[model samples]
Target chain A: MITVRDLAKHYRVHERAPGMANALRSLFHRKYKTVRAVDGVSFEIGAGERVGFLGPNGAGKTTTLKVLSGLLHPTGGEVRVDGHIPQTRERAFLEKITLVMGQKQQLIWDLPPAETFELNRAIYGVSPADFRETISELTTLLELEELVKKPTRELSLGERMKCELAAALVHRPRVLFLDEPTIGLDVSMQVVIRDFIKRYNERWNATLILTSHYMDDVAALCPRVIVIDKGKLSFDGSLTDLVQRIRPEKRVVLRFDRAVSASEVEMFGKVVERTELSATLQVAQDAVREAVSGALARLPVADLTVESPPLEEVMSELFARSRSEREASA
Target chain B: MRRYARLFAVQVRASALLAMQYRVDFVIDGMLSAFSAGVALIPLFVVFTHRTSIEGWTFGEALVVTGWFTLLQGVLEGAINPSLTTVVDHIRKGTLDFVLLKPADAQFMVSTARFLPWRAMSIVTALGIFVLAFVRLGRLPSLTGVLLSLAMLVAAIALLYSLWILTVSAAFYVVKIDNLTFLFGSIFDFARWPSSLFRGVVGFVFTFILPLALMTTYPAEALLGRLRLSTFLGSLVAAVGFVTFARLVWKSSIRRYTSASS
Candidate 1:
C-alpha cells in the first residue's frame, strides 16, 4: 500500500552564533547549513500491515510520515501511497489516509468536536448515513459519549487524544500515519489507543505506520519495526527480530522464599539486579534454560520467570551501537 | 463548490459558537470598530469644513467612502482576517497538515476556517452610516449609477480579498514572515479616502497596481453620482484581474510549502 525509494528531506537552516559580536555580525551576513532531515531511506508497507517507525530525536521518522501523508514535499525521493503520489495531494489521495499528531490538533478549539466532525464530513463528502454510523461506532469504541460535546479545551489530554482519534477516523481512511498518537497519556489510555488502532487496522484492512517514543506502544501494535537514525535506515524487520539481534541475552527473573545471596546468582550468569529476596540475571539465549535450571537448584527460588530483554533496553543498546559504529568510521 | 459551501456554513456556525464564548470581547470589538470608523471620518469632516466640496464631492459623498471602508474592513476583520491568520498560524505551527490531509481544497479550507460573527456589527454600523450619509446628500443616484456602484463595490471587495491572499501566501515560502501581512494592512488603510485624492505616483500605485482605492473609492463615487461609467468598468476589470493574479500566486505558494518539517 506504500512504497518509498531513496527518500530525502533536506532543510537549509540559518546558523547563528552566541555572544554579542557574532550576533551583530550575523545580522549583516547570516550563515546557513543544509541539514538532511531524511536521507535516502526506502521501505515498503503491504496492505493491512501495522509497522512501527522507531528513531531517536532528529531521526526523521516524523519527517518520513509527513512526506508519505502529502504534508511535506520530500527534497529527493519517490513516495507513492496506494498508487497516489503523496505530494500531489489530490482529493482522492487525501480521503484514503489520515495522520494524527499528538502535539497538534485538528479540532476547532473553541467549539465542540462535533463541529469539527461535521466540517470533516462536509469536506470529505461523506454521506450522512455513513457519518452517523462511523461516529456512533467510534464513540462506542473509544467510549467518547460525553467528551464530544464539551469544548476541546475542557477535556484532559487523554480525552482529547481519544477525540482526536475519533476526528481523524471520521472518514474511515484506508491508510493511517500516526505520529506519537499516544503521547502524554497514562498507561491505560495508551492501551486503549493501541487496541483501538489494532482493531481499526484489522477491521478495515488498513495500512498503518506509527511513530512513538513509547516502546510499549510499538511492541503491542506494530509487528514489523523500521528503525531510522541520523536520516538513514538502520534496521527494518520484526520487533522480536530487532530485540533478539540487539540483545541476545534473556532475562531470568527470580523470586525467593528467603533472602538470597547476590553472589550465588552471579555464578550462573551476569547479574543485572538483585535484592534480598529478588534477583535478575542476563543469560545468553542458548544458556537461558541451563541458567534457569542451575538457579532453580542453587537459589532459594519460590517463583521464576524467563523473558527476553526489555524492548527499551534493546532499543537503547541498538541506538548506542549505531552511534558508536558511526563514530569509529569517522 | 457545494462541499465548500457546506463547510463554510459549518465554519460560520462554529464561529458563532466561539463568539458566544467570548461575548464581552465581541461587544468590545464592535464598539471599538465603530469608534475607529468615527475617528477616520474626522479628517474628512475637517476637509469639508474648510470647503463644502472637493472636486465636486460633497462631505456627504466622502462619507460614502468612509462607510464602505469601514464595512469592507469589518467583513475582512470578522471573516477573512481571522481565517487568513489561522492559515498562517497553522502553517508556522505545522498544524496545516490537518487541512492539507483532508479531502478538500487547502486554499478553500484555509480561507474559511474561522469566522468572527460579531464583527458583522461593524458592517451593519457602516451600512447605517452610509444610508444616513446618502439621505443627507438628498440626491438619488440614477439607476445606472446605482448599478455601476454596486458592481464596483463587488469588484473592490474581490480585489481586497485577492490582495490579502497574495500577502498571506508569502508565508508558504518565507515560513517566518508574520510581518509580511502588515504590508496589506497599511495599503488597506489607504482605502479610507478616494483614490483620486492622491495624484501622480501614489494615485497610480493605488489605482492600477494594488487597486486599494478601487474597492471603496469608485463605489463611493458612483453612489455619490460622480462616477463615470468608463471608470467604474475599468475598476471592475482591474479587480477581476487582481483576483486572477492572486489565485495564480496562491497556487505557486502552495507548491512552495514542503509541509511541516520537510
Candidate 2:
C-alpha cells in the first residue's frame, strides 16, 4: 500500500558554534549545513502487513514514516500511499492514513478525548453509525471506559496513550503509521498496546508501519523487519533472518544440579556467562545440537534451553558492522 | 464547511473547559481589558466633553468607532489570536504533525485549534460599549448604513483572518521562532482609528496595502453614515485576494515541510 523510491529528506540546518563570539557573529552572517535526515532509502509495505521499522536515533525511520504520512515533504523522492502522492496531501489520501507519535498528542489537552474523537469523526466525515461503532469497538478493546471522559492532562501516561490510540483510530484508517506508540508506557501497558495494535491490524487488515525502540514491540507485532541506519536501508527482511545474519551463534542456557567450575562450562563452547549452578554458552547454529548433546552427557544433570541472541544485541552488532563497512568503503 | 465548523465548535467547547480550569485568570483578564478600555477612552471623553466635536466627528461618532473596533477586536482575539499564535508554538514543539495528518485543511486546523473562552468577555464588553455609544449618538443608523456597516465588519474579519494566516505560515520555514505573531499584532494596532484620520500616504497604505483600515475604519466609517462605495468595494476585493494569496502561501509552506526528527 506504500511505495517509496530513492527517498531523501535533506535539511539546511542552521549551524551555530558555542561561545558568545559565535552567537553574536551568527546574527550578521549565519552558517548552514545540509543535514541528510533521510538519505537514499527505498522500501515497500504491502497492504494488510505489519512491518517494524528499526533504527537507532537519527536513522530516519521516523522521517520515513512522516514522509509516507504527508507530515513532511520529502526533499527528493517518489512516495505513494494507497495510490496517492503523500506530499500532495490529497483529502482522500489523508483519510486512509494516521500517524500516531508517542511524544506528541492529538488529544485536546483541556477537553476529554471524546471531544477529539468527535472532532475527528466530523473531519473524516464518518457517518454517525460508523463513528459510534468504531469508537465502541476501540473503547472495548482499549478498555478506555473511564479514561475517555477525563481531560487528557488528568490521565496518566498509559491512560492517555490508550485514549490517544482511540482518538487516532476513530476514522478506521487503512494505513497506521505508529512512531514509538508505546515509548513511555509501563511493561503491562506496553503489552496491552502491542496486543491491541496487532488485533486491530488483523481484524481490519490495516497496513501497520511501527517504529519503536522497544524490541518486544517489534518482536511481537512485526514478523517482517526493516532496519535503517544513518538514513540508509541497512537491512530489510524477517526478524529471524536479521538475527541470524548479524549473530549466527545460538545461546545455550544451562542449569546444573551441582556447582561447576568456569573451566568446565567453557568446555561446552564459548562460555558467554558462567556461574556456580548455571552457565550460558555461545554455540554456532550448526553446532547447537552437538553442543546440547555434549552438555547433556558431560555436564551435571539439569535443565537446559537454546535460543537466538537478543534482538537488541543483533541490531547493535549490525549497526556496528554497517559503520565499519562504510569506513572501509570510504 | 461542516468539517471546519465542527472542528472549531469542538475548540470552542474545549476552550470553555480550559477557561473553567483557570477561572481566576479569566476574571483577571476581563478586568484588565475593561480597565484598559476605560483608560483609553478617558482622554477622548474629556477632550470631547467640553467641545461638541473633534475634527468634525462628534464625541459620540468617535465613540462609535472605538466601540466597534473594540468589539470586533474582542471577537478576533477570543476566536482567532489564541489559535493563530499557537501555530508558532506547534512548530517549535513539533506538535504540528497531528494537524497535518488530519483530513481537513491544515490551514483551517491550525487557525482554529485554540479558542480562548475567557476572551468571550471582550465580546460582551464591546457590545455594551457599542450600544452605549449608539445611545449617546442620538441618531439611529439608517437601513443602508446598517447594511454597509455589517458588510464592512465581516469583510474586516475576513481580512484579519487572511492576514493572520499569511503571517503564521512562516512557521513552516522558520520553525524555531516562537513570537512571529507579535509583529502582526503590533501592525494591527493601526486598525483602532478610522482611515480618514491619517494623512495621504499612510491612509492609502492602511486602506489598500496592509488593509488595517479595512478591519475597522471602513466599518466605523460606514456606521457613521459615511459609507464610500469605492473604499467598500476596494476592501471586499482586497479581502478576497488576501484569502486566495494566503491559501497559496500556505500550500507552498506545507510543501516545504521536512519532518523535525528522524
Which has the greatest lDDT?
1
Off by over 4 Å in 1: A28-30, B173-183, B259-262
How many Å off is the CA of B135 in candidate 1?
A: 3.4
**Over 4 Å off in model 2, which ranges?**
A24-30, B2-11, B20-33, B49-52, B117-124, B127-137, B175-180, B200-204, B258-262
**Scoring each candidate complex against the real one, what DockQ results?**
0.73, 0.63
Clashing residue pairs, backbone N/CA/C < 3 A, model 1: none
Superposed by TM-score, candidate 2 places the C-alpha of residue A253 at a distance from the truth, in angstroms, of 1.2
Q: What's the CA error at residue A279 for candidate 2, in Å?
A: 1.3
Clash pairs detected, candidate 2: none
Residues B120-147 of candidate 1: C-alpha lDDT, one tens digit per residue: 8778788887887879888666787678
